[model samples]
Target: MLRWVILAVVVVVLAAGSTLLMNLSTSPGTSWNLPVTPAKAGPMPKAVVEGELTHEFGEMGQQQTGKKSWKLTNEGDADLQIWKGTSTCMCTVAKLQKEGDKLTLKPGESTDIDIEWKTNFVTGDFHKGANIETNDPDHPTFPLFVHGKINPPVVVIPGDTIDLGAINSDEPKTVFVAVYSPDRPETKITEINTSKPDYFKTDVESMSASELESGGLKAGNKINLHVQPGFPLGTMREEIVIHTDHPLRPEIKLTVVGSVSGPISVVPDRLRMVTVKSKEGASGEVRLLVRGGKEAHFDVAQKPEKLEVSVEPIDPVGAKGRYLMKVSVPKGTAPGLIDGEILLKSDLPGVAELKVPVSFLVGAN
Candidate 1:
């Protein structure tokens, strides 16, 4: 009975030892402890943009200055970080407060992003944009827009220039331009002035509300400009200045363009006497033609020295205002280049005086 009980105890002890060695071999000397719950999941970071996302710079003119701003708020449980910002145009600038690359904003906190644009680089209508990079998962990037049309404070209708097309010097021509400011309604045109008052004259009248509304002018005045290309004509270019009540833009400048056509134009307006001898001078003749084959009355203003001028009516009376002007350069004239002008008076009201240039190059005799 003692041997049997000893044998059973030895068997149980050996079994328990074998089970412990098997567990150690499988786990390689590892130990087990109480299970740990994972840390509670937290809310993610987010951003809420407020204020203006887009701005309009109305009627921005040359070198005009303006600015716009927007607010950025951190509405998340974690910190809001603004990484950087970029602009589409070098003319536009974006600004923000510095907090390193990790610009931090606590919950419910906000910051401003200032954007400025100058009209010096743009004309007519323009549009621009900017992007702000942030850490917010919802909005990793924020976008902004800027747009508007450009016009000077003293704005001109039909544009900043007047193209009068082709005009005859023998007839009076007039152009109407509306000068006003849609951007500045309070301003008024104080005085209308022209650079060439003789050639380009201006008359102003109070623009009625109906006229203003019809012409799309919110406020300002209208100018009735009279242009007379005068004699000795070709392409004409002039300028008209407008004085305003505004302090900043006290004067507005505009271009005037036109071409002068003559009623009785000469074939060769300039008489060239190239390579002439001292004893025997050069002579030239010019034919005058009327615009519509009508009669034209003209008389010489002053007879040039060392030259004889005569006019003969066209033969057979086939054409009116058609005449032959014969210019005779006398002999024994001094050698050298001779620069002179032929003056003539006409019955035409628009063309009071006409000047024809004469150039003589007398060779050494």
Candidate 2:
């Protein structure tokens, strides 16, 4: 029995040692030779986007128009696929080529995405963004931006408000007001409208029906605004709304500022409400009475302020001769003056320098 046990122990030890040597020799970095293979190539290179991601137009005139192009290049070994392109605004139009539903680009090849946009709305700064989708595994999504400004539809060279300075009722004076779009080819005035129909009249240079439908007006196309100043004389105000077919300049407001030639005068040439305040952000009202002037058409403009200011037409109806104004200030307003002007627009005869003093003060919290 003892001889058998010793032989068994020796055999076990030898077997264990043999297995350990085999594993060590067969290890990856050990004596065992392994077949060599070429290194696996890194992931296919990705498509590279170049050129402008955004285009900007600053205050485009009524007839202003523009276009832009974006370039896409595939630097990878595999082909790049573009699914589709889209724009958020109707004024923007985008065009690109596609093979059926797929847009494919061969290695080292490039393509262009064209974008055209027009501002036919009112004058202001605008911002827009676009999205691009690709087959790139790493970067499947991309973004682009566009920014620009639309010039004020109507540019009153000297000022937005036409200051007729002053006028005489019996003189029958005529002021020649010129209205034109800066971007000649891109914009044209289609129609002219006034709030008060009987007080003003507009006529444009005659054009054939074909010319009117053919887009913008020709050079030297002129529109005349006829102002008939007939009244009790004081301060007169009216708004002239111009309709156009410009992408960015659809409609514009022209202000008529003037005074009638008469002895009647307003104490404050301009009334400006500086500020309004309240403890819990309350409300209030203000009343303004145009102390002096003959009968005339008068209207009030609610300016930018925390409190809502309104005007109520007084007892005498159809009074179209003087500056009889009333403004309502809201209650519970915080203590402070809101900054805003009481635009007393009129169609009197002379340069009416009427400045009305306006200030808002709130009660104790």
Candidate with the greatest TM-score versus the true structure: 1
Instruction: State each model's CA lDDT, in order.
Output: 0.74, 0.58
Instruction: Give the per-residue Cα lDDT of candidate 1 at 276.
Output: 87
TM-score of 1: 0.58
Q: Which lDDT tens digits does candidate 1 get at residues 1-365?
A: 99999999999999999999888868865876869998746776788878567787666766677778778888888888885566675434444434234568888888887767667645588777677788887799888878888775566678768898877786678889877765676787777777667777788887898987787776677789987667335445668888888765888888887656687677686688787898877788988776777776778776567677777778864767788878877788888777777766767655665656677787767
Off by over 4 Å in 1: 1-43, 56-67, 89-102, 116-121, 166-171, 190-196, 227-236, 245-249, 259-263, 266-286, 290-350, 354-365
- Per-prediction TM-score: 0.58, 0.42
Q: What lDDT is reached at residue 188 by model 1?
A: 76
Q: Which structure among the candidates has the greatest lDDT?
A: 1
Worst 10 residues of 2 by lDDT: 282-291
Tell me the alpha-carbon RMSD of every candidate.
Answer: 14.2, 13.8
